[model samples]
Target: MNQETKQIFSLRKFKTGTHSALLAKYGIVLATTAALMGAGAVSADEVTTPQTQPTTEVVAPATDQTSANVGTPAQEQSAVTSDIPTSVPADTTQDQAVTAVDNAQTTLKDNVSTAKDTGVVVKEGDTQEVVINNGNAAEKTSEVLTDLNQQDKAVKEATEKQAANQKAYEETSAEHERVVKEGQEHLEQSTAEVYQLIDQAKKTGLLVTETTTDQTPEYKDTKGLTGDELRTDMAENLELYQAAIKAGIALQDKSVADLKAALALYQANQKAYTQGNTALKDAKSSGVAELEGADGRQGQVIDLAKKNDVTIDVKHETVTPNYTDVKGLTGDALLKAINDNIALYTQAVVDSVAKQDGSTKDAQAKLDAYLKLLADYQAGKGTQSGIKWAENTTVEAGTAQRMTGNEPAVSWGNLRTAAADAIQSLDRNQNTDATFDHIFKINGSGTVIIKNTTNGDVTLKISNIQAWTAENTYLAVWGAKDGGIAWGVFATTHGTVTGGAGEGATGGNVGATGAILAMVKSYDYEVSTSNAVSTVTFNDIDNNQTVTLNGLDGAKLVKGRNVTQSGNSYSAGAGDVSQASGGVIDSNGIQFNLADAKTVTFSGSHFLPGYINTSIVAGIFGVASEVPKEPKKPNLEVQNVDVTVPEAPEAPKPISVAVQKATVTAPDAPEAPAPVEVSVHYYKMTTTPEEPTPTPTTPVQKAAVLPETGEAGSILSVIGGVLLSGLGIVGVRKRKED
Candidate 1:
């Protein structure tokens, strides 16, 4: 046989012998393709190829065939040549077959690599046998290879997408962590600031406690949180704190103002107290005292230099006695001596009137003057004249009826006794009598004669008597031994006497004598006076006064009885003496009857505003009530604030991208190859089949035609076409043998 024919025959023999083996071998490939199809790895249309016409050929006999074969080599060659299309060259067919086989192998390798890279596992399943008809086996195989490549691409894309998803998730998680950390730090810082403010407020004396109202800022715990939750918590807390601080500051300002007002009030009260004390001091020193009138008719005098804003000048006089005969005597002896003088004087006057004659004008004038003098003496008004006749009066001894009528004897025996008793009972330290007037001190000793001319009774008298007036004037009367009357009147005033008792004759009228005696019984002697006096004067000067009491030498003047006295010094009581006498008498003997004798008077003067007790002034304007306490300062204290940084969002789970095994569905097997005509030559044969003689024809060497720039699927198509042709040849040969 020729070389091409011999190759054909050899392929046919191989196909017949390994048909079952081929089915088994390709079963896995078919199953893999089905798996890819089930997984939607590739489209069916992408794996399918166009069908091609089948070529008819002779099948080669098995290796065990006998030599008694009928067909010769030449005839076999002719049959194969007839089955081939006349329009196509034999060499071109051989080239297509070679290229097809190369493509198939490349496609298979690519599929396997994709499966490994994408982690696609091929699971076991019922092995499907894909029988490819020779007519379009190459195209079908090309389509199958294309499907496999597409499957691989889909898996790669899925892997890439999954990686991208993982990357995005990681980035998001990192951002979340950073935000959480920053938020936590910010929250901590804010909390510290709040605490610092609170501490400062406390230092300023602010009272700060936890927030009790929503309007004030308060602490918030934010732990184990992140993202929106953390942000929201921090924002709310910050707002509260800010509001609280603002309110606190306002309160502090108000407190300061209140304290200032309180301080001012306190100062004002203190100033008022100081002024009041000054005014009180001036009132105490403004009073002045003065004495007037010699008889003690007006006692001590006191004047206020300032009395409701007016000033006054106090004036006074002093008197000196002409005869101080009663200056040293005290008690009963003084009263008696006074009474004896009155009696002697009365007798002399009566005798002088008796000697006067009633015929001449001269004699009558002298008698009238004598009678007027006697009358004045009895009334206590003739103190300046002695008991004697007036000037220009001359009388001769003559018988004249007595100018005075007969009168009874006048006596003050009770007065003399009572006066003596009062003097003896006078107390030195106490005022025994409320109306006690004055002490007339008596001293010198004297003697006098008393003669009664009316009855020719004469009596010798030695004067050693004491006298004083109590509440009235009194006259003394005495009776002579020879039945004659002796009487006299006592006078407070003093004068010199010029005539003697014997120079007068006894010829006076009894009426004159009787009138003189009757006048002594009607005298009233009640008077009111005090040792101390107070007078208030108004003035307009606000100054202190220096009170100088002038005449209080033997007596001591005490201020509100606030003084010390020793020995014979007298104590003068405080306040007005008219209400109650406070003067104490001593052994030195104060003369209350004489104005200038032992009295007190004010010497200096000044002005005073008003009278107010010193003690009360101090208490009224004392310190003001306690100042308003400073309001507690506003404090907003917050300790450490815990904040939770939310855990970084879990890295987004890597996106699951299923990259199934890149499988290709085998193209539906091409239609069965058309039947090839075969001519069988019969020959008588013995036991073995005869072998046909090989023909000496020239061999056609065809180059395989491969797609220059195409996927491996194209080559697989050509390879499948060649294999199917070989199978077709084998089937035709076997049918001819039957």
Candidate 2:
């Protein structure tokens, strides 16, 4: 029989519109093409067989098909029968039918095996193949590549984090070392400065006062410590300080109690000292100590003079009580008698003290001896050591007070009127012009004089009383030599005077003036002579009052000047000399003569401006001089230590990091079912199946082109030739029969 068959496969199913489905379709196309070629070859062989030849019509002995279970029901029902003509051999028909049956059975077995492995069902006795869908591997590959890219980026970020953290740690460590070194240097310098300050204080006599005890209580135990031991202890303390600085603590922030410990060390070292070598040298050069010694000797002289009934003058001059009593003594007897006299003996002590060398030790010893001898003499014991004979008479001890109270105040007007009257009274027709209210000229000399008419004390205030031109003259103002009112200038200059040129009882026209008052005494009107080698003489015309100096030099005079008057009032003056109270002439108003008077003497009670005991005026005239130079400030450098920076903080630990990877998900694929074979049904059964009619052509799809199957030149051409030759043979036989 001729048959046409269509087979349907039971294979794995998949959803459409997905990557997996697309892959399944492509696999099915390949499998179906191969199966179609095999079927075409078999159909060509069937068509070429000879139709006129006889074939066997074989009928098998009937068996119960219902009881058979070798295959499907359709297989059991199906049978093949062939009719053979008389001209053909019966064996040939039987053999041809049997061979056909064997071929069908073999094909069914092959299809069943293929269906099981591919998860597809094949139709029995048919050459059509079943397709199984596989998973979509292409989609998974794309996802895996994307995840790897993300992992690469994360690794790069982690590496950068580690590098940054490492750099920071290194920088912090370097800064820490630098800060430590700075702190070490600061500590060393600070220690050295502290020690230097202590050592200087100890060497000098600038003793630490008791006030430092409260500031430095912790240093109480430093009393017996040597300088080396103290320095060693101080160095040891720096170690503790260094540790604190390293740990980020400020040195200044330490407790007050702790700071006191350092201060205490300095105080203890300087307790008995006063001043450094610089000040001591200055004091020695200036003869300050010597002057003080002379003062003590003068005091001794006074005590001895008073005890031995000597007639000492008000000026502390004239050491002998009665010079007339020793006039008859001569030669060695005169010298022995003068040496035995208490007044000359004390005078010798005073002279010796005045001539002391400018040395601290010598002056101190002289002062001590004089003080002790005076103490003995005052206690009715004669001079301790044998008196050394001397000629000069200069003994200074106590200070005199200025007259005070509501006494009539003297002004420039009062002094001017008095000066005019004195000149007019002394010489008629003498030109006495008042240049200023307080300055005047007399006898063609720039000199004037005034008298005190008040019964009580009166203050004589003078302003601009200076030697302005070359004609150096004298000015004199006097009171009762017995009045004992002292005269002084609040400020004075030996060389030049300027500005203070007006006068009033309360106010005047003058600029602010600095106090030139001496520490001991300063004279108001001082005039130097023009002669290159002459002497200025302070001629005490009235010897009723004597004027004595602390020493031969004016530099040793104690400043007894009061502050200048301002607004109808005078300053509360300073110094024992300036505030001296009594009936003493305090003003320096006396006649000055630029002539050769070798010795400048003071035997009057009047304080005279013409006589300053200093060599500036007392030296040979026309010789320039100045007061001794003041001691210089100590040459000490306070080395300050620099503040240190705190140590750098420790570096933080590095960050732990890593890149995160992405997850990849491929499209889900359908699982393949096991394969099986089923019964086959034919579309048409006739002597020969007719060829199918051709359909309209369809447009091909654009898709991935599969590789070449290799059937183009050989397999397809052989199959087509077989089919054509079979058709030609069949047609030739038909025409002959016609």
Best by TM-score: 1
lDDT of 1 at 85: 17
Best by lDDT: 2
Candidate 1 is scored at a TM of 0.17
Candidate 1 lDDT over residue span 1-738, tens digit each: 101112233222232445424432343343333322333212222332212322222222323221211343434522211111111111223234334433433543454344345443322222222233433333233322222223233333333333333343344344434544444344434444445544444453344453322233344654433334444554455444444444443444343343333333333333333332332223212211111121121111111112212222223222221222423332333333333333333333232222211112222233333334344445543211111211221221111111111222222223232222221111211111212121121122211222212111122211222222212222222322211122222222122222111001011222221111111111111111112111111111111111222233443222222222343222232221110111122221122121222112322221112221000000000001001121121111111111111111111111111111111111111122122112111111112222454653754222235444334244444555666565566546654654
Give the alpha carbon lDDT tens digit for every residue of 129-212 in model 2. 211112212122212112222222222222232233333333433443454466656544544444454444445333332111
Can you give the TM-score per candidate against the true fold?
Answer: 0.17, 0.17
For model 1, what is the C-alpha lDDT against the true structure?
0.26
TM-score for predicted model 2 compared with the true structure: 0.17
lDDT, each prediction? 0.26, 0.27
Model 1 RMSD in angstroms: 40.9
